[model samples]
Target: MSKWAYSTDGFDRIVHRIDGVETVTYAIGQGEPLVYFHGGGTFHGFEWVRPLAGEFRVFCPYHPNFGESGDAELGGMGDYVAHYEMLFPALGLDTFHLCGASMGGHMAARYAAANPLDVEKLALVSPAGLKSDRASIPDFSKVAPQDIPAMFVADPAWVAPFWPADPSPEWAALRARESAAAFASREDLSLTDRALREGLKGFDRPTLLLWGENDRIVPLGYVPEWEAVLPHAELEIIPGGSHLLLDEFPAAVEALRSFLKG
Candidate 1:
């Protein structure tokens, strides 16, 4: 299996029931707890984050209607926030570090804002929840499917390991399902909720805002939106990077490690 497939053999599998649906969580290592919210198929999966497992107990969860998690017909992203608010305590997480990327980042931001005191630190990587000026001509959704992968990373070769030489229908379906859920999680991509803004004002925890310099999906323009909401967050733009920051830049993971462990 390609490392990008990220085998779960060495990890501990934990299941927690929420809203009558069982959610799966894969955990590794033991130290300061660090929960990572994955963007799943949207950002693509890889083993790059495993290195952090050595120093932090990393929890990777599959959001409802995505991956191994059982399906749940939720209202919207706000419902997701409610699901996790219960899921966190059910997992016995009292206080912990949180990291989120892409769709997951958007979820993490809302989660931390609501429960800021439970999080000791927060990290957002290329989160989706804002509307920025169209970065690509005609926009990324209009691009051909085969060409879409190239837009995620500066070097297309980095994604070579992710594609199976002979992909099964099941594999393709899982990817499509995850992508759909990424969108369904948010009814609208705009983060202009007055309640959310007020919540963020009270979230005084340490925060990190990171983005790939060449991120075509979210674009650097959205960075300022996050900055306005989280003026205290530390911002870092990685060079030679794309939307798939972890895949294109080793520095992305290192920067995250430094921020979380600090």
Candidate 2:
């Protein structure tokens, strides 16, 4: 087993094989099901979903090629969407609330747009999909591993837990795998799919767009594009927040709680 395979309080760690890919999932809480797709570099564990356990059963899955999850034969966003199609049924989830961050947000949007009926509600935190002529996503490939944290959060301290003073060989290998997975997912330079934008217009499901006002990776300027595509989406911009707004700001969780409940 990998060093990051253990379960934490309120979350039961389990592995499920869906379509030949073994997926690591953290199941927590009790009420309605809330599937959470975490951001990049969060494959170790889901401390962010711990607070949401009070009201919902949050299932955080490590996407294929990330963490302990087995790699899929295919690549691209569609392959991921298809993986979840098989995964949801194996988990006995017919319909559930969906929440995703950054790259996960991009996947959630594509999933929800394709299977609107399966998603009761959708929450995207600083999502990466949706192209804006004015706003540009930073080239993470060019960023140094140590300096990458600053690009995600407004405060550098938020990433201290993930980056140890002296990382072991195993830890470094894990980080390398995560970085590779991220790049593989975006083989096409265009992260935002034009088809997804059109599909989102027809989603009609209750949607929430939570973003950091100061996000450097996926700028705040893309909010209008998202709003334009998802006409009914409720938009909330966190002040002084960056790409990792949910991590930097606790209020985003409360907002999510209220939105999910409402």
Candidate 3:
């Protein structure tokens, strides 16, 4: 039996194929669909948008090879777009909101561009397409597990509590295995970092760029470039929040609501 846990949001776990790969998605809520793409690694999609389910009908799908989804024939931004293109129409979503975090932001932007006429709004949270000026992408395999928090957040103190106070031997072993799978997919990260540079300049749809002011992973300087790309787009930089601002700062969630609702 699949150990994947379902949600109380009344979402049903459904599977559909795209290019011979089986993808899993949680379909629930009501009204216009909000298709949320997950960040890099093994995170399930609904966990990414659980907080916003009450506001919009959320469609959170796992990318092939992530979570319960199977591997794709190929892995790349184009492959992801093709998969979503099929998945979207299958759900009967003619027009809907789109939001993504980290690598998912890259995929979301690519998908929106491919289907410009279909997306109602776009939201990117600490997106990953733009390369950092000074910080190179860290290799998880090389870094000490203890150093992981610093790479992803500004304050390690805030996140340490989330880990088990005294993790059992079994718990630690499982976590290591989970981390390995996440690192295995590192190559799938979108390489078209410069594609959104000029293309987003003329994007007329309502767009929001939410950044963590203290984000050390992606840096805070990219805000200017993002503003340049979508001059009319709104930006909300959460003070003291790190790369995982949406999870780190509850107020940031309210900001997202205001931006998307408006």
Candidate 4:
């Protein structure tokens, strides 16, 4: 029997195919749909966001070529948007709350701007894609293995459960593969992509700009640009929060709950 067949933890995994490419998503909770897009970092699964299951049916799908998803020829982030064009309908995401973190936030922003789907509310956590001169994204490719986790969170201990103290060659290889996938799919990687920012100029929807005040990856310097593009969007910054604020701060979850409720 499928493990999901008898499981009752409000959790289940689904393997769905689109145009012959298979991607997996972990679903939890029981209510309206809330789709979360992950960042460029190594995605193991939901952590702090797991508590959200109590309120909505959260679907966290591994981007194609990342996590449990099968490989696909991705020309750029546009291709990722196209993938969701097919995947959303397949998964019954007609009118759902949308949330994306890090690189996932970039995709979510693009999708929300371009697609006419009913995104009741959009939540972006430390979104990338907006060009910034004052603060630049550090090259994770060049960062030493021992010092990488600190870039994602204010404290490194938060990631201890996910990353082994001593990563194996296999782990390093996986990180490289994921990094390559993100770099190749992103049309511009110098943290200077105006395509998404320009696209957002016309996007006037209820949005939540959630960020950690101390996010090292995408610094708070990008705030003005975000506010300019999404002038009507609400902004919530957590004190001493990191890029992975969703996992590092419980206040982040509470803020999400309060925003998603409205």
Candidate 5:
């Protein structure tokens, strides 16, 4: 088991070894645990659900090879499931709320489907599991850098904040590396194809599905698809959010908070 050095960000960060993968977890608050699983590409999990931290004890674990989480070349999604299965019990959590966004949301749904007794509630935000009308997912690596910001947010203004003010060689190199790693391994990591056909049928839980009205990635049309399977689930759309609803829509945090509270 490898140890990851979490920056001294004053957050309750801990490292756990499970299924030979060392996961970096950032935990906050002190009530019932609410696991906040972020998207596949990002570095920080705290940023994904910072606003919800006050309402629930949040446990955000960085998946292997992303962010500060070490890489162990996981075979598939089941590796993640095995790790979390051991993790929750090890942390003395027999039951908790599981919330995830994008790829994380897909993982959360799978986790709930596999361990319904352990998850009290589930929230999937702009989730990516269901196979779309298209046979294959668009390759992110093939998309030009200029297209990334547009694909991610409704407003182009949001793009400025993500890019560097001074494009130094080191910064550019690092960004390139991160982007390559993210896009390259997606075929091996994505749950889109199999998740919907096989995984959707068994997803019966108190599920909340959140969508961005302007989400270009998943497209709002997929809402009905989710509703068909998760008939008991409640759905909400945050306006002006593209694929990155949590960051693009300031209102998403409040909307989710209210939904969870209800």
Candidate 6:
């Protein structure tokens, strides 16, 4: 059976082909549809979103060039936004809740801005894509492989799931692909999109900007730019949380749940 099957806690993993591109999708849970866009990493499924299955039919799709998903003719973040616009409808999602972190968050914001009618609500967790002259976002491409874990969370132990005990060749290959995709997608302004930043003002959806107070990858200084553009957005910061605030802090989940439910 698929790991994402309709069991009590499993997600149904399937190969969904959209526009000649084969994408891997994982779906589980009950209630309204909620799509999750993962950050820039070897697309390992997030365990933190499992609890949300009780309240939402969660759909997590590995973006092209990530995980088992096949590569596409994507050039930049704009291509990703356009790709999802087609993928969502092809997947029978007319309108749904959308959430994303890091680079995924950048995609979510642009998508919501472009297709406001498609998103019921929006949640951005330590999202990248906005340029801030005041603060510099760390260049992950320059970060050493051994020190990448520290860039994600304040506590190194929190990255236990990411660090494989038995480092297999397959695992290493997957990480390399993810890194390449991330680097390719963000060759401009270190992944910050001026167009997306300017477009945020047009998005009027009920949006939540969740961040880790101590985030090192995307600094807290970028919060103001997001807020200035997204007037309807609510900013919530998790104390001691790093770039991966959602995974490191339970309060982050609670905050998301409360916002989504409200």
For lDDT, the strongest prediction is 2
For all candidates in order, the CA lDDT equals: 0.78, 0.82, 0.69, 0.81, 0.69, 0.81
Off by over 4 Å in 6: 1-9, 190-192
Better of 1 and 5 by lDDT: 1
Writing each residue's lDDT as its tens digit, candidate 3 over 1-262 gives 3232223356778888766878788777666678877776432225435667678888878877666677655445667788888888887889999988777877787787778878889988877666545444455678787777666655666555444446566545545654554444445223565667644656778988988877766677767756766788889888887776766677777788788788
- Of 1 and 2, the candidate ahead on TM-score is 2
Runs with alpha carbons beyond 4 Å of true place in candidate 2: 1-7, 187-191
**Model 1 pairs in collision:** none
How does each model score on TM-score?
0.90, 0.92, 0.81, 0.91, 0.83, 0.91
What TM-score would you give candidate 4 relative to the actual structure? 0.91
lDDT of 3: 0.69
Question: All predictions: root-mean-square deviation over Cα?
Answer: 2.5, 2.3, 3.9, 3.5, 4.3, 3.0
lDDT of 5 by residue, 1-262 (tens): 2121113254687888766677788887766678877775553225546666677888877777666666666545566666688878766678888888887877787788778888878888988766545323356679986776677678777555454345456445546655554454354333544655466576666788888887877777767767776888988888777778876676887777776677
Best by TM-score: 2
Residue 240, candidate 4: Cα error in Å is 0.8
Report the C-alpha lDDT of model 6 over 34-140, residue by residue, as the tens digit: 99898887434566778788999888889999977998868888889888888887788999999999888987887887888999999999888877887787766
For residues 89-126, could you state the per-residue lDDT of candidate 1 as single tens digits? Answer: 88778999998887778788888987888899999999
Badly placed stretches (over 4 Å) of model 5 are 1-10, 43-45, 134-137, 165-197, 200-202
Which pairs clash in the backbone of model 6?
A: 4-11, 4-12, 5-11, 5-12
Q: What is the lDDT of candidate 5?
A: 0.69
